[model samples]
Target chain A: MNPTACILVIGNEILSGRTQDVNVQYIARRLTELGITLAEVRVIPDQRAVIVGTVCDVRARFDHIFTTGGIGPTHDDITAPCIAEAFGVPWSVHPDSFRLLEAHFPPGEFNAARQRMATLPEGATPIANPVSVAPGFSIGNVHVMAGVPRIMQAMFEELAPTLRHGTPVTSRSWYALGLYEGALAEGLADIQDRHPSVDIGSYPFRRPDGRRGVALVSKGLDAAAVCHAADRVRELIERLGFTPAEGEPP
Target chain B: MNPTACILVIGNEILSGRTQDVNVQYIARRLTELGITLAEVRVIPDQRAVIVGTVCDVRARFDHIFTTGGIGPTHDDITAPCIAEAFGVPWSVHPDSFRLLEAHFPPGEFNAARQRMATLPEGATPIANPVSVAPGFSIGNVHVMAGVPRIMQAMFEELAPTLRHGTPVTSRSWYALGLYEGALAEGLADIQDRHPSVDIGSYPFRRPDGRRGVALVSKGLDAAAVCHAADRVRELIERLGFTPAEGEPP
Candidate 1:
């Protein structure tokens, strides 16, 4: 069985629609490449109880739980302490993280707020941030990272090599303009039935020129099964009198 | 207290990183405009147990639950059935929806696969889809809409008027180039303490040209409190020797 993962995005900004989250997609793609099945993604507020409750819930369910945001030096930056509380561990300054953050900042500038970033749950190891000095941390199965895309990407890159791997999920797709989902659903279902190992999904799209189409995607850990399903999807498109393009609809 | 909402996104395409979701943000912004608090957003796969379980879990917690995707005419379009199961209601074809969809499709073109789109839970009301003829539905407090942005937008517009509203959440923000969060976190916390009603968030950004900055945002249902907190944020930026610019960083 593949290792499963969940991204718990902790932020009021995302929930408020003030920030369009690009973090989940980036991490999802990376987890797919790493062969980890990203089972779920949750965007939640920075409220401490919610953070603590969700972290505890998801950590027990998934092999890896990655949390993003609320690790900064501000009043709402409550992820670290909340996480510590979740694990029933003491939240305090990690001597190494404190030293690193202190050295990174200039003289007399490392205030209490900045020092908050250096605190982590007892026994949690820091996930290095290549972009910024203050680090993210990992305790048990939960890996906490920054919300900013660049910083999160950097932290994930530093942390990826340590995760358990599975067979990377791969996909094959065929799309055609002028092909509607209603026209193709029966054939697609038949194809799906034949390829039980492959997951078949039909996505409908409308191009910029107002043309509608459907993209039939076949995905699985088995490359051959995925390809065979795609071939069947392509055949279905052609049999329905439409030319199949081997990608997402334009 | 404001009514709370949760958006449940159901699709394997999103988890597979094949699709970037714009539905949540659109719904979130609309809900915020309608004065509903969007407390959470969950993206889960197109699996029956997970869907039914999550739907039941969230529906009990929030005043409203908006679900996107898996309402199309394909094998994977199991959201209707799952939702029916979630509510412990009978999953069957609604006569009105059935006739509407049957008329929309050409004769004999409306196969079993297409007929699935017309099916709904026993007590559900269809939400009209202006972009496409097939309708989305609402049962209890859960509003199910299409995953496609255009169709989802249309469905939400139709459903919004019926939802209970509160004082619309509003925000005020001031950003300054070269202002670091570390330098401003202390005063921002002070401002946040003074305005207990407002939510103060400090977000750091790096311009493409490598200049770092911070945007201090004050959000609340109380317009005056939000603005007052933002004014303090602006003053803090000035006190730190950076000119504060209103709104998000360019």
Candidate 2:
């Protein structure tokens, strides 16, 4: 079985529609490349109880748990302390992190709020931020990262090599213009039934220019089965008198 | 208090990073305008058990639940059936929907797969789809809409009037181009503490041109409180020797 992961996006900005999230897609693509099945993703607020409860629940269910947002030098950045409470540990400053942050800031500028970035749950290891000096941290299965896209990507790059891998999931797709899903759903179901291990999806798209098409995608850990299913999908499209093209619809 | 809501985005395409979702932001903005608190958003796969369980769990917790995706004319579109199971009701054809869909398609073109689009839980009201002929539905507190953005927006627009609402949450923001979050975190916390009702958020952003800034946003149902918080944020930015610009940083 493939290793599974869940992402917890903790922020009020995203929930309020003030920010459009690009981090989930970036991490999802990376997890797919690393052969980890991203089973679920939840965009939640920065409420302390919500963060703590969700962290505890998802950590026990998935092989890996990634949390983004709420780790910053502000009052709403309470994810670290909440996470510590969830793990039944104390929230405090790590010596190396404190030293690194203190040295980075000039004079007495590194006050309590700035020092909050150096604080982590007991036994947490820092995930280096190449974009910023302050770091994210890993406690048990949960890896906490920044809300900013570049910083989150940097933290994930630093953390990816340590995760458990599964067989890489590959996909094959064929899209045919003028082909509607209703015309191909039955035959597609037959192909899916034949390839029990492969996951087949039929998506219909209507372009802005008024062109319509259906893209049939087959995905699985077994590349052969995935390709075989795609071949059948292409044949089905041809049988319906529509020309099948590679990749997604334009 | 504003009526709480949750958005359940059901799809494998999103989890696999094959598609970037714009529906959540659109719906979140709409919900904010309608005075409904969008507390959570979950993206799960197109699996039966997961859908059924999530629908049951969320429907009880929030005043409203909106689900997007998997309401198509394909084999993977099992949301209708799963929702029926969640409510412990029979999944069958709604006569009006069946007649409308049958008339929309030409003779013999409306196959069994297409007929599935007319199926819904026993007690459900069809939400009219202006973009496409096929309709989405609402059962109890859960409103099921199409995954496609235009269709989903149409459904939401048709259904929006019927939903219960509270005082719409308003927001005010001020961003400073040269301001770093660390320098203002203390005073920002003080401002946040003073405005007990207003929710304040500090977001740091780096533009592609390498220009970095921090945006302080205040949100609340009380318009005066939100404005008052924003004034303090702007004052804090000025005190820290940075120019505070209205709205978010460019």
Candidate 3:
């Protein structure tokens, strides 16, 4: 099994439905490519206690914990200090981070609030931010990054390669028309029982042109087992009077 | 204070990043409109123990818990049974649900797997599904629905009217250009302290045409206080030497 990971999104905007979260998909795909199992993702509020508590809980359970949002200079951006509290470490300004911001900003532009961005938890490594001068920090297993998609992406690219990884998971999808999940469930269960390692998923989708179907997918670390299960799934679909299509549904 | 909610998305496709979750956005928007505070959302895998444990935890924490996915007829669709286990109730096939499925499907097509859709926890109420015959069930505070966007939307619309709601939250957003969050953080924090009841959020956005800016938002149950805070935010942005624009940044 690959080293597991989790994501904690600290944004009240997302919870209030004022903003649609795009970071989860981006991080989820990147982690999948790196052969890390994204065990969970929690979209939480901007409160300090909640951030500290959730970070502490998830940091203990997963190998790597990625957090996005609430790293800005505003009063609402409390993720950094909360994370520091979570780790029970002394929080202070990092020299490198301070220098980077000092070089980026004009004279008098680096105010007290802006300087707060340079403050990091003790013994933390700064994640390079190409989009903006303010850098995110990595403390222990938790990687704290910006909420903005571009900055978060840049920080992730800089930090992802250094982390340990395991076997990459491979998946195969087979779409079936005029076949419902109920009709195929029994055969799918049998295949699952026979090959307990691979994970099988059935998702129903309706196309815009009045077509509807279910897409059956088999995924696992072992390519051979995944393929075998997919083949059996396709065969089962055909036996149930529906042709198994090669690509995805809708 | 408003009645709170939490969403539990149970699926492997979401965890694998193979599927981008749309249900969260839909539910979040609906909850926001209804004055229900959607406090948290957790996307978890389909494993029975994880599902049951998460469901149990969230159900106790929030006034209402909405779960999506893993209610299909396939082997991986274990949400209904796991929910039953979470509530410590006996799981059994509901008479009304079986009849609904029996009528929807042709005589021989209504197999055991299809019958699995009819099974619900004891004393659970069936949430009517207009898109599909397979109904999602409501047990105590937890409402379990299908993962597919269309079905989930329909189910939510049907069940939303029955839920208890608080005052609808009002928010105001003021956009500003040329001024970064660092320059505005101090004044914003002061504004936050003055309007202690309101939630202020600062989100930076880059426009498609190469312009960049931050949008400061103030939200609260009291519309007058929310407006007062927004006015202060607008003044704060202007005093920081940036022209405050109305609405969100483009």
Candidate 4:
């Protein structure tokens, strides 16, 4: 089984509809590339009780938990401390994080607001941020990252190399032009029944010329099975009197 | 308090990074515009136990619960029945929804897959979909919609007119060029302390000209307070020896 992971996006801005969350999609894509099955994603506001409750819930359920948002210098940035409270751990200024903050700010110039970034849960390992100096931290199985897309991307790149590996995931896709889903239903079902392990999905897309088509995607661990399923879907599309585009070989 | 809402996005494709979830952001933005607070969002897999558990948990906690994904013709689309089971109601093909589906498919052509879209909890109100005839159903406070962005957006549009409204939210933003967050920390804190209701957020933007600045956003129900807070922010920016650009007046 691929290691299951859950993402908790913490911020009032996201919930308030002020900020569109790009972190969830980015993290989800990265986790898939790492062959980790991202099972769930939660976006909670900056309320302490709710954050604590959600963190506890997800931690117990998933093999790994990743949290984004609320790690900045702002007053609403309370994810680090809230998570610590949830895990029943003492939160203080991690030395490495403090050093990174100290280096970013001039000597004796670091105020309470800027110094807030360094305060993480005790025993948490800092995830390096190349774009901005303020580091993300990892405690137990939970990895905390920044909400900013660029910074989050950098932290993930730095963090990915050190995480445990899982089974490789492969996918194949076949597209047919201007065909209704009902026309291809029986054949698609037949292909799916034959390949239980591979996940087959039909994505209806409106082309540039406003023609509709279903892009059938087959994904699983077994590369051969995935390809075979895709081929079957293509044959079905052709039988339905639609021109199936030659997609990447499964 | 405003009528607060939360979206629970369920799918393995989203968590696995194979598919990007565009629904939450759309729902969040729409909710905000409608004067409803989008308090939280969660994306779980298509598993019955997890979906039921999450739906039960969130429904009790939020004013309105909106769920997207797993409401399609496919077997993985299990949201409706699972949610019905969670609510302890018998799942059945709602007559109104079935009528709409029948209109789209015509007589004798409705298969099991197409019929799946009509299944809802007993005594559910159908939310109309203008884009596609397969209407989404709402039971109690939970509104179940499709996973596809276009379909979700259309369903939300149909449902929006009936929802309770609150105080309209308004915002003002001011940008300070070439000023770091550390430089304006104390001033920003003082301003925030003065305006408790208004939400003050600082977003760092790296300009095309290689200049960095923070866009200070003030959001609140009270337009006057938002303007007052924004003015204070602009004055503070000037004191720090940076020109603040005049943004949209509150």
The lDDT values for all models are: 0.91, 0.93, 0.91, 0.82
User: In terms of docking quality, how is candidate 3 classified?
Assistant: medium
For model 1, the docking class works out as medium
Give the clash count for each candidate.
0, 0, 0, 0
Where is model 4 more than 4 Å wrong at Cα?
Answer: A106-109, A246-250, B106-109, B207-210, B222-224, B246-250
User: Which candidate do you rate higher for TM-score, 2 or 4?
Assistant: 2
DockQ of each: 0.79, 0.82, 0.78, 0.54
**TM-scores, chain A, per candidate:** 0.98, 0.97, 0.96, 0.95
Native A-B contacts reproduced, model 4:
0.50
Query: Which model scores highest in DockQ?
Result: 2
Candidate structures ordered by TM-score, highest first: 2, 1, 3, 4
The model with the greater TM-score, 1 or 4, is 1
Number of backbone clashes in candidate 2: 0
Of models 1 and 2, which has the larger TM-score? 2
**Residues B1-250, candidate 2, lDDT per residue (tens digit)?**
8999999999999999988999999999989999999999999999999999999999999999999999999989999999999999999999999999999998999999999999999999999988878899999999999999989999999999999988899899899897888999999999989999999999998888999999899999889989989999989988889999998777
Best model per TM-score: 2
- Using DockQ as the yardstick, the better of models 1 and 3 is 1
> lDDT tens digits, residues B120-234, model 4?
8888898888887877878889999988788899999989998888877787888877787767777888999999999887766676677677778888899899999999999
- lDDT tens per residue, model 1, A1-250: 8999999999888888888898888999998898999999999998988998999899999999999999999888999999999999999999999999999999999999999999999999999987888999999999999999999999999999999999998888899998888888888888889999999999988888888888888889999999888888888899999999987776
The candidates, ranked best first by DockQ, are: 2, 1, 3, 4
Model 3: residues with Cα > 4 Å off, grouped in runs? none
